[model samples]
Target: MTGKGGTGKTTVAAALALGLAAGGHRTLLVEVEGRQGIAELFGLGPLPYEERRVAGTADGGEVRALAVDPELALLEYLDMFYKLGAAGRALRKFGAIDFATTIAPGLRDVLLTGKVKEATTRTADRRRVYHAVVLDAPPTGRIGRFLNVTAETARLAKVGPIKTQSENVAALLRSPMTSVHVVTLLEEMPVQETVDAIGELNGLGIPIGKVVVNAGRPPLLTGTKVSQAELRRGLAAAGLPTDRATVSGLYAEAKAHLTRRELEESLRVELAELGQPMVELPLLPSGVDRAALDTLAAELLGTR
Candidate 1:
């Protein structure tokens, strides 16, 4: 899942992992940003480089999370393909890994995404390890370049293991099984970015998945205008103050709510034009906690 920085893509990705893990399916949630956002969202301490089980479902399903560190991934890559082993650690001690990733940032992305690919395709006894894999990828602004691993690595290595690794990652990303879900809010800038990101993904032949509208609010007002007289009468009937100040305050609040509702509706219309399956997650007034995540997971699975 990917979106504008504050659109809660990580939260949505975590909820998705929980949703997919229902009914005895093991799902892997991967984050490459190195911010430990996943660990924070799950209310856990720092996650190690290795995959660790974070949550489990009542139906025997499980959710495992991995925060892919680029430097460690690079060392793993060295060990996997070149059998560098102790030599890789020695290079890290000399700061060579950091220098290499910094100099060739694209190589860093390769290492990060390569680890995701391994998790996606990894197997035990010829069976897939995870039933589903959800990557909390970079934001929409950098996502196009981030996921286009083939192009990024081509500039660094023309025909080597790096090139081959990037090609494989790119293939998995563009394949039918992979769908890039762009999350957005009911606002102008984020919606526009979502459109642009979807277009870029399309140009790159990456499958576009659902357009997630996060923190959506249901319209409260039944009409564009509320009747002040009716509101005053209702207030009086409810034994509340019916003074002008109270009535006018209520009216103004209703008007503001109507205006926001209209803006959200217009943005919804704009998003609908993209013709992708859209899912709107409700705004959690209490903020996101473990219980809120479970509610969101149920919403995603349409079980709530």
Candidate 2:
């Protein structure tokens, strides 16, 4: 439930899901956006509504992915609340569901939650199916509204099946086992967003399970008072065989790159002030895979 976007929220969710699966928990990875981000990250074809196995239990554990559609959840909600009968048929004929969902405020969030709730409790052939469900939820900013859908409806419908159902859903969201996490970068915007999100979620009684700051570079080469700029000028002195132009250019390039590194270090210092166990991931150009995810998940969960 990270309050920020582009802060590796999806990546953290995916890694956690796969890591749990690897540890032999039959895991379900649910994406609310229906965006292809999860599929693209996992190198799988885009998921359909139906639960489909994306990875085997042998290599990892049983891992399944699903993209929940709010509209379908709305239809289910309608059926549960009202026996449409003739009205349902007429609505179906004219595509009223589609139109209504499109215009209805907060309907998408309600539907999304409904779909996830359904998936979370599902059983397969009388067998306990998924042990854990990882939601690649909406960004931190929208998550409060998204999860508050049930409460919103309960307020609207003071009494009725809708209200009752909404209460039941809300109970699930507020459960102790229902943990919310945030993923962020060491940068200002993301760190600020994380702070804001935590405050909002705590106000709404959502437990902050963890705060993961991914793609953090460690202090690999440190404690050097030999400043890059000072070293640059000193190193700029030409070798016996070198000319001034070539030597100056070499130092200039090194200075620029090292300056960027120093800036990054400043950001990391700011991040340290947050007072949480920040999970630092290496700056991997290629995104997370099973191996990469394993490495990072280990770092995150303190297994490494």
Candidate 3:
């Protein structure tokens, strides 16, 4: 899941993981930014580099969580390629790993994505480890540069193991199994960003997934509009228990709802033009908790 920051991409990603798990798919939820977002969402302690089962589904499928650290991934990469067991620690002591990852952000990205790709393709005793992997990737602005590691590494290393590693990572990303989903709000700037991000992802040859609309407020009056006078008259005719102040408050709410509904409709239309499957999530007035997350996960299941 990815979008402009503050679109609740992490929350959506967690919900997606839960949804997939609930469907009997053992999913691996990977967070690349080192934000511990998956941990916080699941109300657990900070997640380490090792995979741990965070939640279980109704059908007995599991959700495994991992917060990828580029440094550790680099060490693991070194050990995997070369027998750098003691030498890896020696390099860390000399700060070579730090220098390499810091000076070359692309190498860091290669390490991060390489780890994700490894998890996605990993098997035990000739059986797949994960049914699916949900990545809480970087924001829309940097996602292209982050995922397009081959292009970034080519500038750093013309031909070497690093170059070959990057090429493999890129191939995995461009493969049929990979799909990118963008989360956005029903607002002008976010919608615009989602549109632009889709275009950029298309250019990069990444398959686009659903466009998620987060935190949408439902229409107060479904499929109809009422003027203030009409609303007052209808309330009086119904003779429901209400005082003068209460009636005034209801009228004010109706007016606000009408205005918001108009704006939402306009933005919804704008999003439709992007030509991707759109899934909307309602705003949780009680804020996000376990129940809310489950509700969202169930709602997400409908998208399938």
Winning model by TM-score: 1
Regions of model 2 farther than 4 Å from truth: 1-3, 57-60, 80-93, 124-127, 227-276
Between prediction 1 and prediction 3, which has the larger lDDT?
1
For model 3, residues 60-167, the per-residue Cα lDDT tens digits are: 988999999888889998888897988899998898898888999999999999999999999988988898899999999888888899999999999988999899
Best-to-worst TM-score order: 1, 3, 2
Runs with alpha carbons beyond 4 Å of true place in candidate 3 = 238-252
Number of backbone clashes in candidate 3: 0
User: Cα RMSD for candidate 1?
Assistant: 1.2
- Please identify model 1 stretches exceeding 4 Å from their true place: none
List model 2 lDDT by residue over 163-198, tens digit each. 666666677888875888878786778877777777
**Where does the lowest 10-residue lDDT sum fall in candidate 3?**
223-232
- Show pairs that collide, candidate 1: none
**TM-scores of the candidates in the order shown:** 0.97, 0.82, 0.91
Q: After superposition, how far is residue 215 of candidate 1 from its true place, in Å?
A: 1.0
